[model samples]
Target chain A: MDATVTLKDVAARAGVSVGTASRVLSGHSATSPAARERVRAAATELGYRVNARAQALRSARSHAVGLLVSDVRNPFFADIAHGAEQTALASSYVTLLANANEDTAQQDTYLDVFLTQRVDGIIIAPQGEGRGNLRALEEARVPLVFVDRVVDGFDVPSVTADNAQGVELAVAHLAEQGHTRIGYIGGPPSVSTGRARLSAFLEAVARHHLDDDPALITAGDFRRASGGTAAAKLLAHHRPPTALLAADSLMAVGALAEVRQRGLRIGEDLALVAFDDIEWFGELDPPLTVVAHDARALGATAMRLLLDVIDGGTAESVVLPMRLIPRRSSAARPHTAASHPSV
Target chain B: MDATVTLKDVAARAGVSVGTASRVLSGHSATSPAARERVRAAATELGYRVNARAQALRSARSHAVGLLVSDVRNPFFADIAHGAEQTALASSYVTLLANANEDTAQQDTYLDVFLTQRVDGIIIAPQGEGRGNLRALEEARVPLVFVDRVVDGFDVPSVTADNAQGVELAVAHLAEQGHTRIGYIGGPPSVSTGRARLSAFLEAVARHHLDDDPALITAGDFRRASGGTAAAKLLAHHRPPTALLAADSLMAVGALAEVRQRGLRIGEDLALVAFDDIEWFGELDPPLTVVAHDARALGATAMRLLLDVIDGGTAESVVLPMRLIPRRSSAARPHTAASHPSV
Candidate 1:
């Protein structure tokens, strides 16, 4: 068996006290530069590996971050996580990802586990409607960052796409194409993004001087199935809107299917605009029009902020801009006078 | 500062030798029940942790596993990672995921980093062509489990979906739908899945008494753009195919766009089948026919296998079954001769 080199041996070889060696080797910055260099040299000569667990035990800092997300299966959340991972890795920190699966109980258990593991910080994308677990994370005083959605009065660093602006982009684009009666499909009101997007739709319509009908507004759980269900409700009304705005790409795809089921054509019959420009959206027939968030960039930025906080900076919040890409789906509203042959 | 309790303290309180206390704490079998009970009670009272890192150091075993993947942003890989995370968390092991971006240099660097980190084992889905860096992993005698792809002639465990059977299912389904000339659009042959899928497609077509037309087969790189490129090649041919088989969902989506560009409708003018059921596939105008592999289940199973190996079990391979889901896309192949009326 190879002989294990101890800090004491490094200190003796460097001709420094054990405390000085410890401070220098642990990067505590208490030792003089000359002494630190000698200590480092001696440690290198001895091939000394500071027992990470032992040091963690003494310092009570694991240098690990815990990232909890609603679902790992979702590409949107996954992109953010990748960004976090890249940032964390660059900062010599490890991130542990916990999947909440939108279950409060499971989220709570994972939070407890992470706390026990003594991570330096946490980044959470809360699942549905649970504040208890988030409150616990906040109170832990172990720097936290929230992504995609914001919690009211949480006072933590957060990164989110401009939900209202994104909605406005979609609505204004559709209105420009002469879509008077426009429909909105958003996620559940429980989530911040969902609520903001839905409200924004109404505000944007009013701003654009278009008729805001309560019957045209529908809400689902940000799922394609829910979008299909909501589209059914809106279409069954007295007269369906000429254009539809879905808050997510998945929901947009669902709306597209629902429209086709009614023997309607996208862009031509009913203009469509969805948010979150999912990967396949670009390749779709009459590729979807979208108010898009740079998913990967959003993730990477959140991670960088978390890393900054971990590197001993003050907490900050960042709201990223959204870009509206007009695809074939939102080319022109069919019934609009601009699209009609000489009236 | 909290006073640190030593193992000697626990040993004294339990009225047992330090060796006996160590054995009980390490979960090794002890001679007497009373001694075990005393050690357990004493440990509970003293708040002792088994100190996994210390045990690993003394035993020269790191109890850490590394999961290397091509890309984490893809939902397919993310599913596998989620599974691995669940398995690692349950087994009290740490799993590190490294994304290589399908770059050999990046893969090599990550592998080196894993080695320097002294992980107990590794699970890699190599970029498939690089045996150069793998020699180190193999020489370290680290139990390796390859997931998603296999490196030829490497005596390591691998877990992958049955790609051939999956392709056969798609071909048989298309043939039964009365599609005579089927075009196969596959990913690059460098990948194991892509190669196996293309071969299986040909085999299945031959078994059904169909001619193997070179013009009907085009290779892509498992991406949306590649799918479009492959589709264009097949479509531009003098004798175009009535049905198309895409090796992956992204490619299939590309194919969908290409067909639509030519004023062809899915389930009518062109029959389609795709591998990997991406989220939007079901919500497409006509739900896609897919050869589906549950990525999350694959990741979870691979992690389980790694845990077993780390826990003193021998290395083994796990082959997950693939399923073909028939949807609207493969409902019928339209007679283009009638649709065009001039062909």
Candidate 2:
């Protein structure tokens, strides 16, 4: 029972040249129906699996896509990866993922490897502020798309959430609840998403006619520990905020722990809203109010855009929509009712 | 500016033959100190960024390692990938990770891609059923090490958690808590880790002189939804188990949600313990008692073993240690007077 089947056997059974069989099996549309059907039947009969490695070397297309993320442990990225996987699977392509851990050098290394492997395209959630090697990838005519984050001046294809609008929704939600003194716990200001969301928060505060409290804003690196640190700093302010807006879910989790640690009731004592509705958010004790970006949608859209780019479509960018999921965390502000004249 | 630099330029600047420069740059110790010094100086002066891809193609060894995970979204796999990357970095070997998504076909696709990319070695967590096209990969003489799970008959180098021991720890801990009848919810019996853990759970019950209650055992596909289903069945039993042991973290999360949804108090009404100490486990309300397998350690050890295999070591398996992390979830049992004191 040697069971090792090759494309040659498939070609022989199909009565077509090996090249035609290869094309049919690779899902290339150029193959005629008669030839494709023959190849398909032959493949089934022989139990012949396409030799993807040989095909990659011959065609210089790996039939694999590269997915680069800032952090793999974050459920946000995980959701994106899952979405990308589903899309890739549908198209008969596999995804190779790399977690750059926000390291610029690692990103470069992954890009080089992807190039060497000749992947069809790359979808990356870049660690903001590095475009040197990314530009090199573009120069090499590699199909690359940015996901979740965008580069400063690169005219590359991308699919990202409406971070500013999402932040605006969170801010408006808080304002409607009478949260005047609101705190902003954002990711590192170096990242584009963080900067955009923070700016939106300030603009929303002004638009809602609320006083800006500079002391209540603290920055984090989008990790739980950073969230805890930011929350602690904001809470210790001379005039602490009545509500908090976390830039991401991990930060929100950290903030929740911080609030609990201090014996503060989530909805009663302090209101909170966050971004990126990661899985298990709904399962939390007091479900969090969040400006939710569909991570899977972002990944799927980025993959589609990259595939188009790989097929010679004009490069473009996409901004995905966001939704505000209201939960128990944000409620009517307790302090405002006593002071307002409408009461 | 045409920024492409080649080995010839460095050799010319160093006033040495191309062979001498190539050997020196490649870190071949056979080269004399004078030649190496000249090559180093020339490289530094020329700012030569070696085209590692070209070098790899010529020498047939990429200073790269391929890592294949079951799913990138699984925090357990992500941690393992992180560990592998950290270790690969220390050795100056870049790590390329692929998310197989537990699909045999997809896993086969990645194995082919990895082979074509010519990674020096690979660390794979197989999809856990069937021999797959892995036999072809083995025939290619690629250096590979299995992580987390391995095929029953394949004598591949591997590094995995002590699943049996982990289950024993959980069962023993619960048993000591005065819980008699305990339910075991596990993944598909086809998976090595799942079957091993489930068998160990039953064995531990027998060893501890506890009743072998057939109604207390159920299996799922190792999904949260399946865990919820399994939990429902167990809780609905006439004499519900005093404690529950889940095969993995996601299942535990599912069981926890189900228990809470049913208005049963965890750590009191129904004690719960699970495998895989995922990120949110500690942050979970009432926390989670778990048989903690260091996924990071598993990846690092697997990669280390892969490097060894690449360097001519025999294919052997290493079982990493597992421990129990006590949290509030399984602190006490409600039915303290039950005769099955061994939970």
Winning candidate number (DockQ): 2
User: iRMS of each prediction in angstroms?
Assistant: 4.5, 1.6
Worst 10 residues of 1 chain B by lDDT: B334-343
**Candidate 1 C-alpha lDDT tens digits along B28-136:** 5423788889998998898876666756653665445778876766667777877887777665555666676566766776687567556667888876665767877
TM-score of each: 0.69, 0.82
Which tens-of-lDDT digit does each residue in A1-343 have in candidate 1? 1259887888899998775677676675445889989999998898988887756653765556777776676667777777887776665555666676555666776676567556677887765555676787778666778888877768888899999899999998988978888878888787788888988988998999997878888887776777888887876766677788888866787888877787667777678899987776766655789998987777677777776565445657899999899888998564652343321
The recovered share of true contacts, given per candidate in order, is 0.39, 0.59
Sliding window of 10 residues with minimal summed lDDT for model 2 chain B: B334-343
- Residues B103-169, candidate 2: write the lDDT tens digits: 7788888888788778888888886564665777776777878899887877687898998899889
Q: After superposition, how far is residue B313 of candidate 1 from its true place, in Å?
A: 4.6
DockQ (CA atoms), all models: 0.23, 0.43
Docking class of 2: acceptable
**What TM-score, to 2 decimals, does candidate 2 have?**
0.82
